[model samples]
Target: MNHPLLDQFNQWLQQFEQTGSVIDTTRLNEWNHLMDQFQTHPEQLSSNHAQWIKTLAQNSKAMMSVVEALQDQATDSSEQLKKLREELHQFNVQLLLQQASLPQQMAPLLFTHTHLSTLFNEEQLAKFEQLKSSLNTPQFEKLNQLIESFMQWQQAGQTLTEEMNQITELATQTWQEQFDDSLSAKDQIELWGKIYDNTYQVQFQEPSMQLAQSGWLNGWADLKLAWKQLLTQLTEQAGLPSPEQLDRMIEQLDQQRRRIRQLEKRLSALESGDHNG
Candidate 1:
């Protein structure tokens, strides 16, 4: 009787033996013992056990491929972010130099024998200079701050991604180190949960994560506000009630319902008093 499983097991054993450094001696011994048992008492091999083993092998391979893909994506994104950060830094430097040279560059146009110089007197030129100075007002300062903040947010996002990749790799290594083939599916799930909890705890303490969280929250809030504004504009354009108007209408309806409830309570109280009398 030719046993397909026995043949397969023998092939696996032969491959494992050929690759001497693939597994430790103890692990190799364990595989040899299992092979021996399978061959000696083929009837003792449970279909359930075989199925479980096959499923576990498939899942492990799938998980490893997913981890590798994620690692590659993170690496690529990190490289792109590095390039972006460098470009942004260069752009900022150029922008600052251009801003600094603006007055000097424009002064020649206003003061020298140009069309503007012929058209405007000294007083008008002074007013134009004041107008130029007004560009450095509080609003412009806030705009500059917003730009700086956006840059910081991008840097923080990159840092957070790098930290996450490191944590993922560490967690994967730790899980591999602690993995036991003898453990049941439930036990493996519990082990994964513990690994996830530990990784999250470590990640939560990271400064990059905190900055990224804040940036995400702020961005979400801004998005919501912008969306609301857009909705309000659309509603107004369509001659429909805006969000604020709808809110006020809902509030008034609630107040009217409360007043009606109060009146009903008073009427019931009066009727009860009359019946008592």
Candidate 2:
């Protein structure tokens, strides 16, 4: 009874009995039932299903196109980023190469600056004048040019230093105004002390002070050497005794005086003995 071929034969017999035709009556009944279900035409459902499939196909194509476009954009962006990184790396390498040579390039300039500074100091001018006979006109002119250049650089440095000091003072004043306005006197003192220790002392004032002190010491040493050289030349030219020669003469005089004193003591002792006899 449950055999599928027999069931089909029965359906054929039922359709033959009803309409004199061998149509599948069960399928026909199902179509009729579906037609009665909705007020619209049955073919409209098929048409809607077809339209839905077409729309899904179109949407799928459009989504695939968008995905492809996004992939292309991502590839382009990645390539551009790679190029940018490569350029940056090359620029950094160039900067490093320049930095490596900077110290060597600056060394001779620093030496000239210090040398000109040592020679042109106002305190050493007198002794520097004494050196005039030793130098030619060209040498003096060259020295003057170097001194002028050094002075220009020094003036620029001083201007920059003043600007930096002003900035620092302004920043400190701003900080005080912002945070210390309501502080107690003792707290304000502590705040300033901290600020000095943390910022101004370390960053500005202390280094500047140390640089000035070092310059003074170096200038003093150079001045002393210049004075010694000047005096030695003057003494030699004037036919006056040098310091070493003067020391030797003083040593001889001291020895002669000691011998005279010893002789006088001996004579005094001899006289006393004679008187006692």
Candidate 3:
């Protein structure tokens, strides 16, 4: 059984050989074995490949959902920030009004000799003047400055949230465009590849996108770690090997197999040398 892909691979291998390009024998052998398996069991290989592709499509759909979720989160954050800014402004206005009315409200307590005498002595009355002076000058100014700083901070936050919303919206739109139902599987895969490349470029170029990407990657990493831990615990409870343990076992087996292959190659070389001798 001949495959066009295998024929193309053979052509490339022949070209590499004619060009005297170095190729890893182990990798070449692996490719040859895989091709041989595909040739021998075309139906089984095709079925498996189709299943793998289906899995990829499912993953891509899941990714689309994640992107949409991110967009919703960003929009929610922007709205929340806008609401907070409005509340902050209202609070600042109320605070300033309270601060302005404080002197009038305390006038009798500070200046009325009869009321002052009931509350404190002459020394305490004198200190009240200082308190009034401080509040009227430095404290009032400081409160205004603090409110201004808070407003500035809120503005910065609003700007950041807006940028995040825009980026997420663009990403969502791009993904939706790529995931056309009319597109074939191969075209969808190619479009996804292009999306990845474009996203990679944009992430580097846009600082906001880079920050968003970093946060997303960190969140995903934490989620993956938590999932793995859960899996490990579940597997332990079931008296089965965890994925990490199985992976380590596979790695050790591969190393042992590689060592055996190397020994066999050396023995074959020695045998050939002896025959020549």
Using lDDT, give the best candidate's number: 1
Candidate number achieving the greatest TM-score relative to the actual structure: 1
Please report the TM-score between candidate 2 and the true structure: 0.24
Q: Where does the lowest 10-residue lDDT sum fall in candidate 3?
A: 112-121
RMSD of 1: 19.8
Put down candidate 2 lDDT per residue, 115-224, tens digits, no spaces.
23112245444444444434556635444333333343344334434434443455455454556457895786577557644654454455664564344444444433
Backbone clash numbers for all candidates listed = 0, 0, 0
Enumerate residue pairs that collide in model 2.
none
lDDT of 2: 0.48
Q: Candidate 2, residue 17: CA error in Å?
A: 99
- Model 2 lDDT at residue 195: 60
Q: Between candidates 1 and 3, which one is better according to lDDT?
A: 1
Candidate 3 lDDT by residue in tens digits, 1-277: 6566557657767866886765455645655554555555555535658555445445555554444444445657555445434433343334322322212322343243211112133574456445545566642543333333323332333444444445444544586665687988679758865764575467558877566445444443443444455456567769999977988999999999999999999999999999999
Q: Is candidate 1 or candidate 2 better by lDDT?
A: 1
> Per-residue lDDT tens digits of candidate 1, residues 97-164?
23222123323433332111112235754564465466676645433333333334334444444555
| Runs with alpha carbons beyond 4 Å of true place in candidate 2 | 1-179, 183-194, 204-216, 235-277
